[model samples]
Target: MFDLPPWQSWEMFGACFYAVRINALLVLGLSTVTLGELLPGTMMSVKTRSISVELLPSRVFRCTDTFGASSPQRISRQGNPLETIDWTSGDWIAVNDDNGVGVDIFFTLKEAATDNVVVFVDQRKRQFGKFQPCHAKDYIDKLSVCPDFLVARGARFVGGIMDCVSPSNLEKFVVPDDCFILSQAGTELFTALWRIIQRVRLSSPSTRHAKPPSRQCFKAVRKKWIKSLGKL
Candidate 1:
């Protein structure tokens, strides 16, 4: 449920759980949202494009036979695709591989240059079988698709700025009322992402010089979504 083209697809909802990155940091989403507060230092680590993290309480568990994960807390354990379309391509991007790792763990390739902003979804060998280039409108009900994962207990979704990961210092990010791009952090994050997209399309992929957030440098960039300014 987390991956889809934000400009297109079911992901028109702005940001999502899958397909995330910011200043080179990967995103971690959770389906088990908590109404209560979690303690500090709680985290879940991922082995992806970057060694990303997801902060959460230990009440949740990973999606494996064992209750273990990188961090002490239980992992929700789960969780996108596309390329060469419009910036607002109303669809999410992903890559297909029959013998690949899986879309839930897929990341944008450094060399798979395309003329469009793309999200890479690695189709799992056992689940989706092989990946197909699709969009939000396609709305395939196949396993590991965005819609299904969003509703899945342990899976996380990926998409746009909404699909970014939180620093270890912050709590697990919960999507705000309108999504956070209007805030200072959101503005910087997406602006950088857009620049990266442009560079990639031009076949000159290089990230901005911004440093990752340190504990002292971190900022909670939450913002209220406003329907008047635009459509999600």
Candidate 2:
């Protein structure tokens, strides 16, 4: 017979030892396994059975006290200030103040529901390191009020923000308590946002200087994004 590889041999030995140990435990009444289910084959069969687990849905919150209200009151949760901005259908870009530090520009997509609002952060502002402690707190606090999840770039930057916050504050004010979920930015999301911006720029009748992309150029960009995603 052909010899098994060294790693494979060790794995087989480990499995056999585990089985024997389990069987011995069953015989000595040290395990919960029934007398009828003492065989290793029976144990394996039981383990292979499909298990059903129910996951609870995430809690959704209202963005403001009144629906379609232009100015919503700032709410407080666990001693942290939750800022609310006026609802906007177009891209809202905010510039840095005289201090050269300000909130990143965000695009308010739509009201997912009467009470829930979906907001998207500009992927260009992935520079988490550039944010000072006060800036980070301001950014995160604003995100806390969004009823729907916010999509942004830079998973590493998100992790860095989480690391900066204390564990108790993170759990109580940021994650489940605040009903916020941070999703890692994907190529598809970025491409979709880019396409929307391009469409808006070209479709604007007022912008006579804006040039639309050629069919070939559009195809090239699409292919490049597809290839990048495929590599990932």
Candidate 3:
């Protein structure tokens, strides 16, 4: 009963066959797979009865059981309980430029159930972005002081108002250069962010790039952002 998605059916069968071939009778007997189905008229429900076994490529075995709960109960290869994560659709924030004109968007991919931020995404362009695994506080600090800190190592822009209109600013917004490689989950989150930004731009292009109402407004937003991230 190696239940898996339609796409992974072959992979699951392959793993099962390999296990049998390797004479892992104990593993094959202990392993069970349960496929979940949504019950009609329910908000969201999973009907699960037993434990599931996942065989890693290295042949390490892990078991997970949810028993209809939202969080899984995992057992490592050593038979010790493992931590669980419930990742949800994440949120985003928009940062204003130095002169308060133009905006750069950042996103936090988080696990809502565990209150963890897996990574921070900095959207440099429509097609390019970077994900930093640092703590939210550290990332925000670097972003506030120098938005280009990740891309530009030593270069620092001078002047106050002129900085907003600098060609470098435009260049940063448009240039699709080097980008960090993303895991499958990270790629999904990035695609979600792109869709959200596109919708925002379509609804109100000017508002998407508009300056903050006031410096106080910017501060208020930043404070709220930090407070929300503090829980992560």
Candidate 1 lDDT (Cα, whole model)?
0.24
**What are the runs in model 2 whose C-alpha is more than 4 Å off?**
1-87, 92-102, 115-232
After superposition, the stretches of candidate 3 with alpha carbons farther than 4 Å from their true spots are: 1-92, 98-103, 123-232
What does candidate 2 score in Cα RMSD to the true structure? 25.9
Scored by lDDT, the top model is: 2
What TM-score goes with each of the models? 0.19, 0.21, 0.17
Instruction: Sort the predicted structures by TM-score, highest score first.
Output: 2, 1, 3
lDDT of each: 0.24, 0.26, 0.24
lDDT of 3 at 66: 16
Question: What shift in Å separates residue 227 of candidate 1 from its native position after superposition?
Answer: 39
Please state the error at residue 22 of candidate 1 in Å.
Answer: 2.5
**Candidate 1, superposed: residue stretches over 4 Å from native:** 1-20, 23-73, 76-103, 106-140, 145-215, 218-232
* lDDT tens digits, residue span 29-87, model 2: 22222211211121112222111111111111112232111223232111122633332
lDDT per residue for candidate 3 within 1-232, as digits (tens), equals 2354442333233223332322221212211121110001111112111112221111212223211112122222113335322211222222222132111222222222333332222312121233222221232233322333221333221101101111221212211111122222333332343343334334443324534245554454455344433321
In model 2, residue pairs whose N, Cα or C atoms come closer than 3 Å (at least 3 residues apart or on different chains), thus clashing, are none
Tens-digit lDDT string for candidate 1 (1-232): 2244332332222223223222223111221111111111112122122222332111111122111111111122222121121211212222222222213222221212222222223221211322122311121222233333222323333321222232221233332221111122232433454454434334311223323345422222111112111221
Q: Which pairs, if any, clash in model 3?
A: none
